[model samples]
Target: MTPETGKTSIPIPERTRPPRAARRGAIAIRFRPGPAAIAAAALVCLLIGLLYLALQIRTIFSDQLKQEYAGLVLEAVERAESARNQVGIWQQLPDATEARAAGYRHARTELAHRLASLAALVNASPSAAPRLSPASFTADADLRDTDAVLGTVSAWWRAQRDADSADVRLRIAHVARTLIASAALLFCMLITALGMYAKRNRLLAGQSHEFEWAALHDAMTGLPNRRKLFATLEAAATKLSARSASCKIAVLYIDLDGFKQVNDSLGHRVGDEFLIAVSKRFRESVRKVDVVARIGGDEFAVLVREFSTNAELGEIARRLIACVVQTDLTMGVGMVSASIGIASFPDSVDDYHRLVAAADEAMYRVKRNGKNSYAFADRAN
Candidate 1:
């Protein structure tokens, strides 16, 4: 199939392949991808959890404080009414001046005690303690009105006591309502902050995962590139290096024999198609344990970690060659062939670089000696 790159061509297997450079270049470009992108989603999730917890704490405090404030205000109003009634009866008796004065003294003391208790309750809330003040209750306009009404009744000791008592109760109720309103506002603000933080965290995490996937994959061929290949190889080598089993690493360098003619004859479009076809063939022919990579122009390498004999190696090479040679091309070119070079580790060379070099040398030998042959660098004893 024709690809978007317009660099290679797909032809029937019968046609000779195009230039190796075009095929390799196209494959490399197809698979290369950008670096890993940072995921902010995880961070976002963490922040959301924290913010939610904080909001919950705030809400609990607001609810508790509001309830407590309402109770205290009601208790204060009841105490004021009781004290006013006791003093009023003494004043009406006229002969009980000393008793009335003593009750008034006791009544003022009770009011002070109740106010202190309310202040203590407000301070007990961990979240609200820093924000609340004794002055908030005492300075409240409704509370002030209640205090004024109580003072007037105590000073006059007349028929105005019932009217003043009603005013004090209404004022206390108003103060409690104001406290609840303030608490509701605080709750809304906390929840809003939590929502904003959660949204930010999700965005960050999604980006991070997106970038990670991009890093491990090839952008074009959707295959693992050299970077991923080397990582796996390094890990495998470390595992095998510790063992002395008859384990062997086989490195194969494959080059398309007559690929240049395809590019020269049909055009670059057909050449790219031929390269994609070659990649597909390699995938189909290689064993499950083998990894193939397109390192550069028309050149592919395979790392095979298992194989007991040269015959086994030859079988794999023949399969690869056959896979490519047998492909049908529609570009009207003749049959194409591949030259494969094989090298083994611990048998031909000790180092990875030398091993690859040996395989490369063997591949050139195949090209020089004959186009469609597999060559080996290892000497037979």
Candidate 2:
């Protein structure tokens, strides 16, 4: 094919080094190369888990601070009532009314201040619970005994405050325990994210590599085409020349006989199967070192390397003829066959044109001699 077809010529990128901006964009895009559905689900789950943990902690601390503030308020009310009782007891004594009244006034003022503080604490509990502490308590005879009915009944108020304080402490401990559990879960989620990222990156890399290979390779048959064949031969010839190896490379030109007849007689549908069968046999006939290509309609070529004598080329050509003849076309034909032509490198020519021309000339000789035969060209003749 000529360069005008735009198949053989590859365009070089404007910048050998990709632009910095492009590199950054590619990294950003590649970073999220994970499956969209799976990534979205994982992200949603992570957010929900974190929110659940936060709400649990909030509920625990909120209840704790509320109970603590309520206890403080109850304690202040109990102290106020206790002071009023003392005032009444002092009033019963002669000449102590004024002194007891002043003490009662002071106690009332302190109690008012404590009540204000408790109001502020409860009001701020929603926001400040994370930092608030439980209330401090004092013990007395009335608070210690419940059997003293009058004594216990008077102290029942303080008992309520103590119970509230206990509730507050219990909630705080529950919050702390839950926070520890949440931290462990967060660590596990982070580990899972890391492993998933690595696995996704590897998968994307492999897919990218496979995509590149598929771009240049034929889908029907694994063999290269004429364009790839030419490129490979050029590279191989350079390497072989440098080594100065006593090697002769030969090209086997193959044309499938009665291929068109099979297509015409048994529909193109069955013909496709026949072609696939032919491609398989071609692959089996060549050695690992050989490069094979489907150059045209019903025509294939094989580049055999490191042959020391004409006898080796003749033997290979004979094997190829036998391989095609032995293959069952399944189209109810007598026998399938291919005429092969052998052309050697260096001895044939120094340039690509001369080498290909020699091979083509040999192929025509096979056709002229009779079908299902082989021929080799001699440059000296």
Candidate 3:
């Protein structure tokens, strides 16, 4: 200890950091959006709603303003007309200082005030601003509105000293008023035109549906044609594919046995009537769910969605033959019967044409045996 200055040096303390656990805890705190952020989002939504509400209010207000403005324009026009009449009377008078002249002066003042108010109203909205434009006021066939009338009045007020121009302006103002009246009806006409267009479209849609129906059906018998029958069969085949092996659909291909004889002996008119009667009988004999189609000529087809047994099919076929043969017609030809050929799904394969051919072959077999009988397609021949 060399105590030369007699003052000892002060020792500096070392800095200490926070504990590791405290540091980790501070860092691991997950920041989530708090109540303030939620409130801000809600406020934004409120603001949007308010803005839309304001826009709606503005639209309503603008419409009301337009109606009121139109009324005011009409009133101003009436006043101008009155003023014009007064001016005419005043000019006819020997004394220019007559009560009529004083009345015209008052009318002019009132017209000016009305015009100023109209201008202010037009200037209130940007869209309405067009109402106050020079083009809207011009004395032309193209320019006829509230603005044009107001413009004519303004021009007349300024040009009253010029007698000729004032007279012309008054006439133009009358024309403008007429145009405004007609213009209001223009809206109604447009609405009516739109309604007519919509009605025409609806009619066209109905016609289109009818046309499509006609294309798919026989005009005479009102039964599904070959195209419709094929489509229905294809759909049935798809459905049958999903069913159990035991489940089956039956196709009864029928031909009116004596239809040709009637068609040849009787007129086509009688034949058609007879065919129509046969179609009705066939429709009555089959179940409502069954599809009956007139493929062509006297050839017809019936698709039974689900037929359980061969006996059930035979019963339907017998009914068809009996119904047709029993019906007494105007024609001298006594009676006609149907030869039905039954072909079931899975047994005859799902192919529509092949099924029809098999049924047709079976029908020929029946025709060979007897005209009035029905037969099942034989797998062998």
How do the predictions measure up, each by TM-score? Answer: 0.50, 0.55, 0.51
Instruction: Report the candidate with higher lDDT, 2 versus 3.
Output: 3
Q: What does candidate 1's lDDT look like per residue over 1-381, in tens digits?
A: 875676667875887787999999999888643221112433444455556556655655555555455455445545665654554455466565777778656655555555455445435534322322444334222445445654442343322333434555554555555456545554555555566567667777888876865686555444556666666667666667887768877778888877787778777777677767777778777777788777555677778877798898899899888767766354446756788899887787676556667888899999999788898986534
- Superposed model 3: Cα runs more than 4 Å off: 1-187, 243-245, 328-332
Cα distance off (Å), candidate 3, residue 166: 16
Task: List model 2 lDDT by residue over 1-381, tens digit each.
Answer: 665755577888775788899999999987754445445655666677667667766765665655565565455446545554553455465665777767655654553444344334434544322221222111122322212322332354346546656766775676676667656666666666677778889888999988766665565666677777777777777777887758667788888777787778767776666666767877887788788787766777888867888888888888777666666434456545788777888777556545656777788888888878888876645
Give the best candidate by TM-score.
Answer: 2
Q: How displaced is residue 204 in candidate 3, in Å? A: 1.4
Candidate 2: C-alpha lDDT: 0.65
Q: Order the candidates by lDDT, highest first.
A: 3, 2, 1
lDDT, residue 87, candidate 2: 39
Candidate 3 residue 260 Cα shift, in angstroms, is 1.9
List the pairs of residues colliding in candidate 3. none
Candidates' C-alpha lDDT: 0.64, 0.65, 0.69
Worst 10 residues of 3 by lDDT: 135-144
